[model samples]
Target: MLVSALCAMLGVAPVWVSCLLFAVAGYALLWLFSPLTTIMIATLTAIAVLSFVKPHAGAGSAVIAFVALTANNMQNNLTASNIVGMIIICLCPLSLGFGLNLLLARRQAAAALKQRLDREHTARHLHDTISNDLAYMILRIDQASHRDPPFDQNQYQRQLADLRAIAATALDHTHQAIRQLEHTDGPSTHIVQSDGETDKQVEQQRKRLDDIIQSQRQRLKSLGFQGDDILGTFDQPLTDDVLDLLEGMLNELYANIAKHADPNVWYAVTVSFDQRHVIVSASDALKDAGIQLGLGSGLERYRAIIESVSGTFAVTDDSGIWSAEITFPLCRRL
Candidate 1:
């Protein structure tokens, strides 16, 4: 509206002056208003200038001056030539704004996707590292409860109590991880600590696997499963890396059994070690519902950890029984 008013005032001047004002007004409108509006104003200004100017100038000179004058007219004119010029000016801003908006939208979307990926990565890391270690701790505590020579009974009891507390804490952490996966917000920055203190954490964690099998044995017996003792030997003491991975695997297996296995069925867990590798296996009788075949997220993550350290995993569910087998190299010996 301001540009239009200015153009109106300029139109009252001589043809040359009016042409200059028209050009300025047209350019201003192109910058401020829609491209279409700028073109319309320029077109109108061109026609007005041509109509007001006399033709007494020579044809060639008239043509040249007309062209020059029209070029100077920034205001939209009613004439076709002026209209075209206004349209060209208006298109500049329209195209530029549209392209800029598109680029910005894409960048925002990419940033959002990256944030989601990072959050998921953090959740998986927490589950694989922290949750698994806690599970292993529970297993070891349970095993310690059933030792042959038997360390102090009170100490064993205390350990069992600690195991329960750890289990509860791990469950809470699992819930948090699930929430994080479902969230749309940015990634968490909090750091997680694993249970083992030294480089031997992994070996220590592996020994705890025997404890888990022992505890499961008791649970199975209570449910009327007359099973043999779990058999396994460790070639090396537990290290932090092995402990972290095994803990995750054990937790996944326990969860599956708790959620899907029949309470009345018998099950056995066994581990065997050689100079080169260690194998851990769990076998359980299936209920009428049968064992679900697909690997759960916990197990899948464990599998990934195992593979990352050059290990192998296999799961089998035949008839009504399920078995999981994991084999990994013994990198650090006891």
Candidate 2:
């Protein structure tokens, strides 16, 4: 109706007025129509034809009409030289709006990919680190319960408390990963830090690993298997990323041993580390277990995590003993 009024004010003929109305209506409907470009092009062509054919109208008048219609609709007063100039100016908003929408969509897609990667990374970390530690801890607790001198309740309770703390910390780390996903742009947070305050966090993680290993040894003793030499040897400090990955890998190995290894079988875990690489060798009896050395179902996921940090992992099952060797370059601090 406003377009019709504007055409009337311009003293256009009835035919020209009808053409102008058709063009305006067509443009408006384009928003809800398929092939928007087709609709827009048709509308612009109609307006041009009407402007040329109208008795008193000329190129200048047509340009003025086009500019007026667009300005009125967009609530902007813009002037252009000719009809062609007016059309060009009118396309500016549409171009900008479309470009902006595309940019935002791309950003959203990138963020979603990042979140998925993070989730997988967390899963592998937990599987490799926490799972192994817990298995070892459970084994120790089992052994402690069957001690020859009779299990000391106070010592057992202390160990149990320590286990609970480790479990709690793992849960906390998982929660932090979840929160990071939920609020990707909210703030920067760290799972563990190297600052003086983070010393306590580091000690807690180390203690948890120690407790789990101790528990496994105790459990082995109760089952009549000697586990005297199953100790972790750390010759070099581990970077945060490497530590996280190793912890996850060890957890998976320990869980596998607890679930499959026989009570009478003896096992030993030796961790050798240097500035360039780390190797974890597990020597255990597995002749009757029928277990093969290869990438287990869980290892496929673990492999992805290791690869993300430019690392490599390999497993060798020689006779009844299995050794998982993971080698990766040290990540330099930026």
Candidate 3:
């Protein structure tokens, strides 16, 4: 309805009126499309041909002008027929503009779909290569836990910390995914200089890692464990992707400890960086109750995560103690 009324604004019969009709249609088409140059030639040609036409627009005027022009041999003047023709001519641009906009909208939608597929490829790359390591870390924790006896309060506290870490990391991923899907002309996306934003994201990664380590360590300390108790130290710049992988591993490790590790044992989790490596080592001088257990597949997944970042990984089983070491290299950080 609005389209028809707006089209009627060019209802008058004049060369300028035709220009106005085409101009409005062209603008609408441009709005519906991207890379305006792609459709500009077609738009100009169609508007030029269709916009300038017979002027008689109303039903009665159309009949009168036709009779005057053909039967009475009149030439080059607005007659009743021109009035009807103007209505029909204006209607052509209106319909053509509507159709062009629809076609352009479809093109935009296809482009958006392609961008989404590209984003999914990126996400799958991370999940397939890195996230698979969570399994290995969990298995080690479970192996240790089976030897320990239950201490309700300590176990619960540790579990809570891990659960929060898991929740936080999942939420971060979900929001990041959503942004990837709906990203265009938003404040979160910078149109200009993005170095500051990168710095800010790196800072956030550091903070999240610190919080996870601190919370779990606090639980350990309350039970008279300190110094060598669940220690984690980060002394280097961190990337968001590496931070996410580490966060997931840490949370899973904590959960495994809460559920499987000896309640009375000491554990140290440390993170330090060198020119070539951002290394993480979790070692526990586990007080084994000598419960024989099979090693789970979690270690394999852990190995995959480390290797995906081009890091050397080791899961050590020696003299009744278990440790998983990952040398996450700075050279390969993403």
Top model by lDDT, which number?
Answer: 1
lDDT of each: 0.60, 0.59, 0.56
Per-residue lDDT tens digits of candidate 1, residues 1-334? 7666666776477778876776776587576868766655554444433333422222233344446546767464558877565555444434444455567679999998878655756666586545554655644555555666447889668656756766776677777667766767656564444544433543555557767666555544433355444556553455444554555555556555544566676666666778777777877666664436667787786677677767888888788778889888766421
Q: Which tens-of-lDDT digit does each residue in 204-272 have in candidate 3?
A: 667777887786565445433443533344444555456656666665555444434555677777776
Expressed as tens digits, the lDDT of each residue in 138-225 for candidate 2 is 7656665676643788966776676676577557656765665565455556554456645665566566556756655554554456
Q: Candidate 3 has what TM-score?
A: 0.41
Kindly state the number of residue pairs that clash in model 2: 14
Question: In terms of TM-score, which candidate is strongest?
Answer: 2
Select the stronger candidate by TM-score from 1 and 3.
3
Q: Which stretches of candidate 3 lie over 4 Å from their true place?
A: 1-203, 221-237, 287-299, 331-334
Per-prediction TM-score: 0.40, 0.50, 0.41
Query: Which residues of candidate 1, in runs, are more than 4 Å off?
Result: 1-207, 215-231, 289-292, 332-334
RMSD list, candidates in order: 16.1, 13.3, 14.4
Off by over 4 Å in 2: 1-91, 121-186, 189-212, 219-225, 228-241, 262-265, 287-293, 332-334
